[model samples]
Target chain A: MTETLKKFVAGLELDTRMLGMIGALVILWLSFNMFTDGRFITPRNIFNLSVQTASVAVMATGMVFVIVTRHIDLSVGSLLGLIGMLMGTLQVHILPQFLGLEHPLIWVITIVAGVAVGVIVGAAQGWVIGYLAVPSFIVTLGGLLMYRGAAWWVTTGQTVAPLDSNFRLLGGGAEGTLGEGLSWLVGIIATIAAVVMMVLSRRQKNSHGFKLKPLWAEFTLGGIVIALILGFVTVMNSYPLPKGAVRRIYEARGEEIPQFAVMHGIAIPVVIVFVIAIIMTIIARRTRFGRYVFATGGNPEAAELSGINTKLLTVKVFALMGALTAIAAVIASARLGSVGNDLGTLDELRVIAAAVIGGTALAGGIGTIYGALLGALIMQSLQSGMAMVGVDAPLQSIVVGFVLVLAVYLDIAYRRRAGQ
Target chain B: MTHANAAHPLVEMRDIHVSFGGIKAVDHVSIDVYPGEVVGLLGHNGAGKSTLIKVLSGAYKRDAGEIFINGEKVEIHNPRDARAHNIETIYQTLALADNLDAASNLFLGREITNPLGFVNDDAMEAETRKIMGKLNPNFKKFADPVSALSGGQRQSVAIARAVYFDARILIMDEPTAALGPHETQMVADLIKQLKKAGIGIFLISHDIHDVLDLCDRASVMKNGKLVGTVNVDDVTDDDLLSMIILGKKPGEETITS
Candidate 1:
């Protein structure tokens, strides 16, 4: 009876760990708001924070899988750095001289090469771990140093500057993925899609004779999510920078500005992360490949005896990690607008912290994409908040460290209390 | 009673040899199991019975051996190869992924999927329910991970997995060792049902009483080699024990228990 009540209160059925992490994120946000005297919770700051969290959040999503399979990759930071520098060279120097800056083929080739390099690097590492029988720790640890060295070697420790304008926009510029009206349209469409999916899934579960949330509970969830989406659109629409092109003309004429809103929508990288999260969630929840991954992580001996190719799974996981690292590289480079020797310095620690904080088991066989993203958000929020409050960098690190430990400790205690 | 199956054993393992780091785990042991027959492998600990059966289940590669199934020579290289031959083993450990639910464990490698390859979880769960209904009617918690289940219940899930996959040759390592008396009876009935369906079973057990109650033929092994295989009706439990303990055939020595 108590369990049913609690489930009803939650409105949406989710693992308590996921709920707790989300709750922690909320608490973290509120505390930051209090610390910064309401300056931190503004739509602009939240928007910026979301964009900034994209790189680590994206990598954290993939890291959840790697860690779930009872393996670790310490080379992501270096891989990100190397991929960023390689893209930088191609976009700013190599391609411009050959194909010219405005040529459409240049961006296409550079982007394709970037993804190819990531896959090849990942596949090679995966092959070594899966087929050649090298332990992932030793393999990726070697990758850490080798890739970092390669990053330095690529441009001889020089910073590659002024990436393409199109690429620049993806890193979170004044321009947006969608205009103001289109943003509202997408938001409404997404909310409708969510409701439709809920209905279909509920029908499927009912057909399977599974107990389901009551109609009121379902309605409450749909209402909350739709409200949140519309709210987010409202906030983005209020950013008010590129006001209809007429505002810019009026300003040029030294005339009074008209009271109108022009929206830049959400950042492209943020949208990319959203799409990636959706695809990953479906894969994790609905696909055979995903089931095999969890099974292999849960028990390698059982998985192998059940005819799952565990060694090959290990390799594929690393390859996917590499592919995601390359994607992160694109975002990081675009955001920085310059590729430095230390492009992704010490970033592996951040995503590892995020993944674990989101309740991914160090012991393996458990993780979620949303959990890791929320974990990333919490981490970035603390950093961004502390910086806004003029906290010393060293002190911020100490606080962040304590927060990560505290979050994980609380999660462990909760699981124990719940007898998980 | 079928003359067709009496012509040849469903499975024949000849002179199986497996070594782990120069230690002969299974050495020159041979066994044959006929269809619709329960062949009890009786041995003390370290007698290489489990190791010997593992070679047929494809968990371990025999250094020297030729396995013939259904009157044809076939190579058993890995678990996948063994599965292709419809051979399944229910290990003493149950070999379940504890984090996955019973249905997931039941369909670990072979999952039902839609056109896009997304697993049809509903179909899998329904199938699991149908099979578990036959194997263990009292089973209720289909969504709970195998780790959360009791020893007997876990055994049911493992058995359901084997039977659902259409396995013709079943190898069970101490299937009733951890089960209670009531649960053990359930397995006994299940064995009878499988026998009725003409499935061949290799029941590896240290329980002499169980062997007497269930086995049609008893093969005793000692020190990685087979002592002898005898008809259960032709010998007493004491004779089987002597074969197990003294590595002698039944007629050679009898304890007269």
Candidate 2:
């Protein structure tokens, strides 16, 4: 028992970005509730916050990869805008003639088309950056302007609106009378993912003839996370809907009525963001490609000597970032039900800030996908809390900017201390 | 004493010449290293010691000459080819990534992977411990990055990597230039251990004391030309200095040393 206790302490001391992010998130939640007279913890407000943060949070996941490799893609925001515009244009102008499909099929095609555009554009930029050895800053900076201009040219500086009903459902859709079911699903999936990851890593270590972490530590952490997720779902489910709020479905005239509900249990954007975050985290942590990413970031010259094709790795990273930007664009456009030239204006700064604040070094080397997501959440929470207190946009911007600078300073300070 | 004649020389270079642009960096220099023997290459800075080693390690291609390993002539046009011939080089800078641990540095370019294809850290750590035990039993490298290690420990890691890869000919450039007394003694012990293992080592140094202590035969160069090779036991530090300064035999009285 004494040895087990000692092992438990060691496990707690392990260096992990996930635990840090969780700690920060808890602090942010408590502070927001304390300062806003408990208004910030409302079910409606929480759901709204999830939807609002999903777009940028998803974008930052890809941005983490680019930043870790000591490269920047200033073109991400513009790529998002261009992808959104392409989806909108295809749904409005080309879907009818391109295919006779309707509803769900057309929605699927539009999303795929958006993703394709993102991939093509990303590959073009990656080729220049990797093959020509052009500085990523210059290539991506040029891409930022060019892609934004392309978006404007595609739409002629006009907003495309009145998206098909099916497309709208993708952003804010309802599935049945299972209120809070989707949120519960997300919570369960995340907990399961966390548990599976821990088990697989342990197994991998043991198979490779390495020491394994104490079983109790792993189980205790996993159990606590699962319990917390269940508790969150219960709290969210218990909140009573405001009086006269529209029900999602109503039985009338011997037919079902699709009521426009604000909380459709879970926002599609939130689910999309969570799923993407999980996938990216797996890819970055558990694969050979992930090792190459870390190696390239840590020391490019050493990586080259180690026989890693550093150029291919760099270009692939950029391409992956592009794909992520497109996923974010899809979620954004689906939520807004329209796309315009200014869809992703100034979003590049937020994405980069999210990665930096999450502890990804701007100098290239160490980072985690979860860190970027947590960084985005911290930004989102600050923005949402300030808005709840009736703070102006400019003031909120200034506060976030200060937080970003503070996070970077803290990162540098931590590294310096570690160096010593 | 007769072992040097009984066993074939580990490495031999014939009329090795390397030039950059129009100037010859290493002009017609020839040297040989016998198994289990230390050979010192003495020269001033820019006097072609480094250039000659670079050609042997295939870091630089020779404009002319042939290299033989164990009496079999071979072409080493690149570092990979040099490794194929069991020739390893320890450069002045060490070329080690400071952030990596000793084990990672040991198998930097080539790592042991498990069935899952991830780097097998445990296997590597175990192998590192085993190798350190044999090479430098006093080395304590557990969980420490090379950056945090002492200068002697870092050198141990570099030498261990070369030796672990089965290098028959070890080329060390200025191995003890920056070491203190104690650290220098540690490296000297390591050199004796390598000599016992029957591994031929090329010790390049400007310190006459190190050459006299560790080398069996000392070869001096002046202006990219070989002066002569002398058995370390038969020559004095003054004799080696005369060869370097005047490019002549010791006791000719032409150069003051």
Candidate 3:
């Protein structure tokens, strides 16, 4: 039976580590559902869980590259806080004064300004790390403190609120989602794209006379992917809008409320996370930049001898991390409809934890964007699960801390065994 | 194979000087190689042979010198510039990224890309397979990282990388140090083939036998200075050892081709 199972796994061409992580996730979800008496697995809770995971998950994907390149950005959380504050100030105080309070372009300008600040600040820090030859740990730690102070100074530690309504949609709410029809359409299109990509890759391998997976194995993998995407879309489409929200929509539209409720297919923030995951995965796998990052991490002298501009690559990687933090800030602030100095406090730890648990080696040269996303999901599940089980805040923190160490220890053991 | 005397030298490093802080790693050292000629660089530890060659390979910027390729002066401030002039080096350390597979390390900076500018990994793997098949017929572990390979396998991977790029100027630093006798013979044969193809090679080695068997000429360095250059046929093992050990040139009576 073990031999047959091994053959089945090999036939699917799946990474054993990835399968293990998925298995763990399923088990975790089942236990959580049991603890909540089936409440945790409901469509409503799952949707909320997805939205909650989005912000950290987005940043965690970028952290994979950072850690893979043998660097750390201790400043990401503070950077998010600073960017969120800047954005809140722009949309709330500055832009409204110029654009006359509710201009269609206010949200766009605010977002652009926030992202610009993030990239510039991030690149500046990268310059110091790469060109100045300073350790990344020290530089980003300084940035952590400096940016947190800067965020506090933005509004003298006061909260900025009443942001532009359109911007809030990016944070994902009852109205900030793709409806039932659009969500299914997206899932179908994604499924088709994935199959086409697999087929094209197989053809490419064939042309090059490389080994290929069997046809039945390929079909099975395709079937699995289709089932996953469709399953997710189905769950998302089952969650109907709350009664108050439905009534408000009718009242705003000057129409009587319908007897039936409309489904909230998928949150905008969740879609953003998925899109970012796809883009980051492509960048990590297909681009020369990604290759150089890993090569430099593996051996800096080798990369330099190979004609790679490793210093410049470092700067670019850090700048990319900064940009991602800014996006996370947008989601965090928009979700709350306000920005405070404490908006992303302690988020750096969560981001790092997620990346580590996802199997980004601190020693550098290996990581996956998808793995980091899954890691973030696992972290959020643990936190929310504990909360639903009425665990105290301190106890939740203790469990998370223990789980983080345990997961990494297990991952290291797995790697040692598989590699041997 | 004999290099043409009248042919322009494939590589010329004129009066190269490299200093680190207050120490002179290579001082006023000059060397040249003609097409189809292999010049062995012999030296003691810290004798500055590698430093001088690094100037030519663009691994180290010379404080003072000019590099000429095929009689034309060229700027080689970095490895990219060296590669542009078709110069490739296999260092003593076999500078392969340990985390990457053979194909990734082979193509490295110069990857095979599709029209969309994405790396064409399959094409690179196929090319790597073809080359490794010729270079080391037993090398079948293409999917494993270089770190997992045996020392000899890793050395061959480094050699294949330099050879695959069609380098006009090849630098092999202790290329056979990690190889078994059979692999050493294979490399010697490969060098013969590369030399017959008119590639200029700088072979750095501690083994006098390898120099005698493979190189056309030998250049000895001591205390960051070149002692002398002599034809391999004109010098015996003791004569070269005297030059490396005592900073002395071969006796006048020993000057014979």
Kindly list the per-residue Cα lDDT of model 1 for residues A1-420, writing each as its tens digit. Answer: 999888677756657677777777788789888988998888788778988999999999989999999988899999999999999999999988987885777656767888889888988888898889888889999999999999999999999998887777678767635657877888989998999999998899899887788888788888888998899888876665655554764676699877766556777888888888888888788998899889988888999999888888887888888888998998899898899999998999998998998888888988889899989998999899889989999999999999988888887898788766
Q: How would you encode candidate 2's per-residue C-alpha lDDT over A277-309 as one tens digit per residue? A: 877876775455766676677677655544467
What is candidate 2's CA lDDT for residue A194? Answer: 76
Global fold similarity of model 2 (TM-score): 0.80
lDDT (tens digit, per residue) of candidate 3 on A294-371: 898888899999999888988999999989999999899989988987999999999999999888888998888988
- What is the RMSD of candidate 2? 5.1
- Fnat by candidate, in order: 0.79, 0.16, 0.86
Two-chain complex of model 3, DockQ on C-alpha atoms against the true structure: 0.78
Please say which candidate is ahead in lDDT: 1 or 3: 3
Model 1's chain B TM-score?
A: 0.95
* Shift of residue B118 alpha carbon in model 3, Å: 1.0
Compute the DockQ of candidate 2: 0.22
User: Which rank order by lDDT, best down to worst?
Assistant: 3, 1, 2
Measured with C-alpha atoms, the lDDT of residue B112 in candidate 2 is 80
Cand. 1 Cα-lDDT: 0.87
| Winning candidate number (lDDT) | 3
